[model samples]
Target: MTQENFNEGLLGFLDASPTPFHATQNMAGMFENAGFIKLYEEQRWELEPGKKYYLTRNDSSIIAFTYSGEKNYVMVGAHTDSPNLKVKPNPVIKEHGAVKFGVEPYGGLLLNTWFDRDFSLAGRVSYLDSNNIIKDALIDVKKPIAIIPSLAIHLDDKANQERSINAQSDILPILSTSDDFHFEQFLKDQLKISGVDEVKELYANDLNFYDVQNASFVGLNDDFIASARIDNLISCYVGILSICSIDESKPMLFIANDHEEVGSSSTSGAGGSFLENTLHRVFDDYEEFVQMIRSSIMISADNAHAIHPNYPSKHDANHAPHINKGSVIKINASQRYASNSKTVSRFMNIASSIGEPFQTFVTRSDMGCGSTIGPITATRLGIETLDIGVPTFAMHSIRELCGSKDAYSLYKIILSFNDS
Candidate 1:
C-alpha cells in the first residue's frame, strides 16, 4: 500500500479500538487480512516452518508469530489495555428520581475528561445456560448510552482550570431520570440474562465507558492525532502490521498483551506466563530455548511522554522528545525500561539502516521513572531489549494526542526492525 493508505488504515484502527478487547479484535482482523493462519492451542499441535500464525488469550491479549528457519527471534511487544472506569456488578441503582451506577476505576484514569462527554459501553459478558454451561459473549451498545454531566460553571466558580473530581460521588454517570428500576433491568436485558437468575452472578462484566466520539486527525495542518487508548494501541497496531509485512527468515513474534495499565500483573500481562508459555510451546525443548535466547532480541513498544507544550517545565530540558521527530528511546536509571548499551546500539543500527530518525529520553534525575513491559520481558527471557515508542502527550489520560507523522514514522521503524 502507498504511504497515505497506510496512515489512513492506522487512523481507522485507532478510532475503532477504545478498549483492550476492541484493540485485540481489530488486530486479529488485520492478521486475517494479511493472510495469517489462525492457530488454537487446544485444537492441535503441528510443526511447520515458513507459515504465518496468530493466537489470542482471554479475548484480551494476542500473539502473532512467523518463522523461516532463522536462528534468532525478533519480537515486538505492546499492551492492548488502557485505563478507564469499569462498570460494577449490579451497577444500576435508583436513588430519588435519578438513576446512577457504581463504577470502579480500572486504572489511572483522567477522571475529569470524562465529564460532559458522550460515552458508550463495550465489553464481554458471561452467563449460564440451561445445561449449566457457562457462555461468554461480546456486547457493544454502540450508541451514546450514558453521560457524566458537569455541574454548571456558576455552581463551581473555579471550574475552568482548577477543579477536583471525587471519583465516587462526582463521577457517577446519569443513566436516566424516571427510568430508575428499568435501568437495572436495562443492564440485565443487554446481557440477555434472565431476571430470575438473582442467585447467578450477573454483571456488565468488564464494561467500561468510552467516549462516543471517533478519533481524528486535527490541527490547522492536520498534523495532530487525537484518540483514546493511543498510549499503547498505536504500538499494538504497528507491531501487528510490522510482523505481518516481513517475510521472516528468523522466528518473529508480535505479542499484544493485556493489563499493562495496572502494572502488567494479569495472567496475560507482561509479568505473567503468556509470553513464557508461548515461547515454551514454540521452542518445545530445552536446547531450542537456549538457542533462541542466544540470538533473540525484543523491542518493547509503548507510548513515551512527549515534551508537553503547556507544561514545558515538567520534562527534562535536555531530554525532551518532540512530536514527528521519530521514535523515542526511553531509558530509566532504575532499569525500568530494560535498555542497555549493546541493545540500544542494535536498535540504532536498525534505525540507521532504514533512514528513520530516532531520539532518546530519560527522566530527570530527581523524578521517579515509569516502567514498561520491556524490562520485565527482557529479564524473564534473558533477551537483549530496547524500549521505543511514538512521542505522545497525555500518556495515560482518557484521550491522548500525538503527531500523525510520528505514528507513521514509528510504524516504518518497527516494520524495518521486524523485516530485519
Candidate 2:
C-alpha cells in the first residue's frame, strides 16, 4: 500500500481504539473481515494448518496466528493500552457547584498536555439488562464533552517556568456545572443513545478520558502524523498490516496485549501466561515445544523516543534515532529492552533486504530507560526477542507526533521478515 493509505489505515485504527477492549474488538473485526475464524478459549479449538484464527483474553488482549506446519514461530508483539486518566469506580467529586469525575493516571503520562483540551469517555461498561443478564457495552462519547481546564496564567505567575500537577486535586475532569449533574443518570442516558437495550441502571464501568481530536497529517509538508496514543498504536497497526500480508500460512503470530503502561502484570498482560498458555495448547509434546521455542524469534514492536531537537543533550550522542529515518532498534545493557546482538542482526537483515533505513537508540548512561514487552515475554517463554519501534516525539502526551513515512517504512520492514 501507498504511504498515504498506510497512514489513513493507522488513523482509522487509532480512532476506533481508544481503550484496550475496543482495540481488541476492532482487531477481531478486521480478522473476521479478512476471512479468519474466531476461537474461544472455553470451546474446543480445532486448529488446522493453513487456517487463520484469532483469540482474545480479558476482552482487552488479543492474539492472531496462522497455523501452518512450520515449527519455528515468528512473532510480533505490541501493547493495546495507552497512558490516560481512568475514571475511578466511585468517580464523582463535586466542588463549588461544578461536577467533576475522579480520575487516576493509568501510566506514565505527560500531564501538562492533558490540560485545556477537550476529552471524552471511552471504555467498556457492565450493567444488567431487562433479562437480568449481565452485558458489557463499549461506550465512546465520540465528542468533546469533558475537559480539564488549566489554571490561568493570571492565577499562577510562575506557570510558564514551573508547574506541579496534583493527581488528586488538579486532575479531576470537569463534567458540567449543572446542579442536576447526576453521574448514574448521565450514564444511563448515554447507554440509550448508544442503542443499548433495556438499560436498567449503570452498574460498573472501566472508562478512560481521551482526546476528542482525530489524528491528522501535520508539519509544513504534511510529513507528520499528529494524534493521541501514537507511541505504540503505530507499532500495533504495523504488526497487523505485516502479518495479514503474509501469503503463506506459517507458525507466525501477532499479539496486542493490555496493561503494558503500568506493567504487563494483569491476566491479559505480557507478564501473564497469555503467550505461554496459548503455545502450550497449540503444541502437545513438551520436548517439541521447548525445541520450537528455541528456534522462534519475537520482535517486540513499541514506539521509541526520537531525539527531540530542543533536548538533544538528553540522548546519547551516538545512538539517538531520527524521525523518518526508519525503524529504530532500542538497546540497553540493563535489559530494559530485549534486543541482543544476535536478534539485532536478525532485524538488520530484514531492513537490508527491503532497502529500508534504520537507526539505534541507547539512553545516556546517567538516565534510566523505559521498557517494552520484549524482556518480559522473552524471559517468560524462553524465546529470543528484539525490541524495535518507529521513532516518535512527545511520547506519553495527550497528542504525539511521528513521521508519516516512518510508519509505512516499519510496515515494509516487518513485511520483509515475513516474506523471507
Candidate 3:
C-alpha cells in the first residue's frame, strides 16, 4: 500500500480495535484476506516452508508468520492491549439515584484524563451456544453510551491542586439513570446483534469501556494522529500489515500479545508459554526449532513517550525523540526496556540501509521507567530483542497523539528488517 493508503488504513484499524479482542479479530480479518492459513493449536502438524500462517489465543493475542528458510528469523513483537478502564463482572453500583458501573483500572492509566469524555463500552462476552458449549462474541455499542464525569470545582476545594480519583466511586462510568437497568440483558442483546442469532444464556463477560472518539489527523499540517490505543495498536498494525504486504524467503513472525499493559502474565501473554509452545508445535524437530530460535531476533514496537513540551525536563535531553522524526530505539539502563547496543546497532544498520531515519530515547536517570513486552519476549525466548516505537504524547490518556508520518516510517523499517 502507498503511504497515503497506509495512513488511512492505520486510522481505520485504530477505530475498529476498541479492545484487545476487537484488535485481534480485526487483524485476523486482514490476515485472512491476505491468504494466510489459520492454524489451530489443538490440530496436528502440517508445516511447510515458504508458507504463511497465523494463530490466536483467547481471541486476544495473535501471531502471524511466514517461512522463507533463511538462517535468522525476524520476529516483530507488539501488544494488542492498552491502558483503559475495564468493567468488573456484575459491576453495577447505584449511588445517589444514579446508575453507574464498577470498573478497575486495567493498567498504568492516567486517571484524570478520563474524567470527562464519551465512552463506548465494548469487549468480548461469553454465552452458552445452542450446542450447550460456551461461545464468545465481540460487542460494541459504537456510539457513546457512558461517561466518567469529573467533580465540580465548586464542590471540592482542592480540586485543581490535590484531587485524587477514587477508582471505586470517582471512576465508575454512568451507564444510565433509567428506572429499569440490567447489564446482563444488555450483554445478551449485544451478543444477539453481534452476528450470532442463536446466542443463548449469558454465561459471563470481559468488557472494557473506550473513548468514543475516532482517530483523526491533527495539527495544522496534519502532522499528528490523535486517537486512543495508538500506544501499541500503531505498532501492532505496522508489524501485521508489513508482513502481509510482503513475501519473505526466510521464516519471520509478528506476535501481538494481550495483557502487556498489565504485566503479561495471562495465558496469551508473552510471559506465558504461548511463543515457546507454538515454536515447538510448529518445528517439531528440536534441532530445527533450536536453529530457528538460535538466529531469531525480535523487535518489540510500542509507542515511546515524546518529550512533553510541558515537562521537557522529565526526559533525557540528549536522547529526547520527537514525533515525525522516526522510530525511537528505547533503552533503559535498568533493563526496563530490552534494547542492547548490539541489537541497537543491528537495527540502526537496518534503518540506515533503508534510508529510514531512527532516533533514541533514554529515561531520565532520576526517574523510574516503564516497560514493554520486549524484555518479556527476550527473556522468554532467549532471542535478541530490541524495543522501539514511534514518538507519541499523552500515551495513556483518554486520547493519545503521534506523528502522522511516523507509523508509515515504522512500517517501512519493519519491512526492511523482515527482508533482511
> TM-score winner among the candidates?
2
Return the TM-score for each candidate structure: 0.93, 0.98, 0.97
Clashing pairs for predicted structure model 3, backbone only: 68-249, 68-250
TM-score of 3: 0.97
Task: Kindly list the per-residue Cα lDDT of model 2 for residues 283-379, writing each as its tens digit.
Answer: 8679888988998899999999899999999899899999989989999999999999999998898899879999999999999999999999999
**Between candidates 1 and 3, the TM-score winner:** 3
Give the per-residue lDDT of model 3 (tens digit) for 49-70: 8888999999999988886655
The lDDT for every candidate, in the order shown, is 0.81, 0.89, 0.88
Off by over 4 Å in 2: none
CA lDDT of 247 in candidate 2?
Answer: 62
Worst 10 residues of 1 by lDDT: 194-203
Per-residue lDDT tens digits for candidate 1, residues 80-129, read 98888888876776886788878878778778788888888878777665
* Candidate 3 ranges with C-alpha deviation above 4 Å: none
- Quick one: ranking by lDDT, best first? 2, 3, 1
What's the CA error at residue 95 for candidate 3, in Å?
3.1
Best by lDDT: 2
* Clash list (residue pairs), candidate 1: none
